[model samples]
Target: MHLFSALAVISVTVLQAAAHGYVPLLRINGKDVPGWDISKDPYTTPQPLRVVRGTKLDSGFISDVTSPDITCSIGNQKLPPGPIQATVAAGGTVQVLWNTWPLGHFGPVLNYLAKCPSSDCSTFKGDTGAPWFKFQQDVFSNGVWASDTLARNNYTYNVRIPSNIAPGSYLLRHENLALHAASSQGGAQFYPGTFILTPVSPTTPFTELSLVCIQLTVTGGGSLNPSGLSFPGVYKATDPGILFNVYRGDAANQVIL
Candidate 1:
């Protein structure tokens, strides 16, 4: 079976949300690893053990498609737990936990994998070049859109590591694009917005954040580096995928992946 395809199509389903959300926890092989704790990490000296590459604050996002923050999240360069942690077998699932998701903001959920050069993720920055490979994508259908994932699964979006990829240390990038306000240039959230979450059939426009990364090590997989796409170079502000009316229809053929 294609590892990521099953869970990748699913997204977070939330209710009673406010503005936006962020990644704060991850489940690797069933173990709940604390992501960057936006609420307590800053104040707590000797910061607690965090597994995922975390942003400074919780429940935030980015609107600029050209910004490097789109690669991961702001202030999310690198973090401790270095020398490899958060290991998962190939074909396993890592649950990305979004603290809060706006009921209005809706779009496709995506996941990428960039194997750290030299097998060390601490020094490798994933912002530039085409090192990031699109492995796990959502709703590859017509008119289907951002999903009701979290509400059904306890606020966690499940990302299954592709079984065919090589085993090594990788930076797992998780993102949810909010295209509710994307009718104009630069309004889409690579990093939040409004819209319907149900999957619509036939005609419609398509779509950001809830962008975050985790330093992950994959074991028991084949050897292969998939071709990748750059972040800032991936989505253009004017591109139909980024600029379009969600209520009307999608530009990327309504293919929410």
Candidate 2:
């Protein structure tokens, strides 16, 4: 209740807000679809229609690298998927829209896809043991961090759907790794977005990454299963990509990054 204490809380709140964000909209097939609107969804009698999976998010992430959350968003593993699913060609594109991204959060952007074995993305929760293949990534290029580009571009990025994958329901896992505070052992910040696709695509307690799930169904004649890395098992706290300091002013230190 003290003035100084209240001011300290305010400052920390702003800092955390500056550090992370979430997917609020998605562009599919040239049409824009609203993503989860955390503010209005809780009170609506019928949830908003969307392709992106429904999730309650904050400036939080899974730092343990071993938590199931690494598979999707925080606590997303337990939430039911959205009621709608978008369809696209196997080789289409989806534009992810971040609610907000601060220039201060600098790092890499990665994309992964995993197929839903049951063919029903709504019922499929790609948590532990799910095979996720890394299909796209934008790391440091031309002496600029991917996050920098994301912020510069209004926090929007386009992700290409794989053309060679089989037709089926899938989960797309999109991510952004913020290394701005990576000097310490557990200072990495990761933002992940999950999308369901017919062609495509945790545990941890650490506030290390932000993630979202998107629902998609792919329809096309293509078949090629991609070898993948499982979440939780995919990242480790000691890994150079998750723990090294980017302030040293150098290129990325690890491949997993």
List TM-scores for all candidates, in order.
Answer: 0.75, 0.78
Which ten-residue region of model 1 has the weakest summed lDDT? 8-17
lDDT of 1: 0.60
Best by TM-score: 2
Hey, what RMSD does candidate 1 come out at?
Answer: 7.2
Model 1 residue 172 CA deviation (Å) reads 0.5
195-233 in candidate 1: lDDT tens per residue?
222223323333544566678889998877785577666
Could you report the Cα RMSD, in angstroms, for every candidate shown? 7.2, 10.8
In order, the Cα lDDT scores of the candidates are: 0.60, 0.62
lDDT by residue for model 2 (1-257), tens: 11011101000122343346667788888888887655455357755666676554443433355666567655564455564677878889988988777786667777878888766777666765746777777777777888889988998988888888898887887777666655555333443332110110122212234456677888894888774467657666566665556777454534223
Off by over 4 Å in 2: 1-19, 57-63, 186-208, 253-257
Best by lDDT: 2
